[model samples]
Target: MSGVDAFPGKGKVAHCDKEKFDLKKELARVTRERDILKKALGYFAKQKE
Candidate 1:
């Protein structure tokens, strides 16, 4: 009924799903790096005190 359905066997939707997955993976990686940096900063701050 919509524009995507009219295209039949086209793979456009799959491409969108892959893009979404990539974004989620990138977000997770950034969060992990941020947590690691935070812990390192805390350790250094304690050493300075």
Candidate 2:
């Protein structure tokens, strides 16, 4: 049993592998973006008051 097999019909083998290869980088980038977005939202909220 492998990661791809664990979930069926999600994608082709190459596509799945591509995502897995970049999963860590993608995760870090997304996490950073989320934090930046939260801070931006907080700033806007404060400014509205």
In the predicted model 2, the residue pairs found to clash are none
TM-score of each: 0.72, 0.58
lDDT of 2 by residue, 1-49 (tens): 9986887874567877788879978999999999999999999999999
Runs in model 2 deviating more than 4 A are 1-21
Clashing pairs in 1: none
Query: What TM-score quantifies how close candidate 2 is to the native fold?
Result: 0.58
What's the lDDT for all of these models?
0.92, 0.89
Model 1 segments beyond 4 Å from truth? Answer: 1-13
Task: Write down the RMSD of all candidates, one decimal each.
Answer: 4.1, 7.9
lDDT of 1 by residue, 12-32 (tens): 568888899999999999999
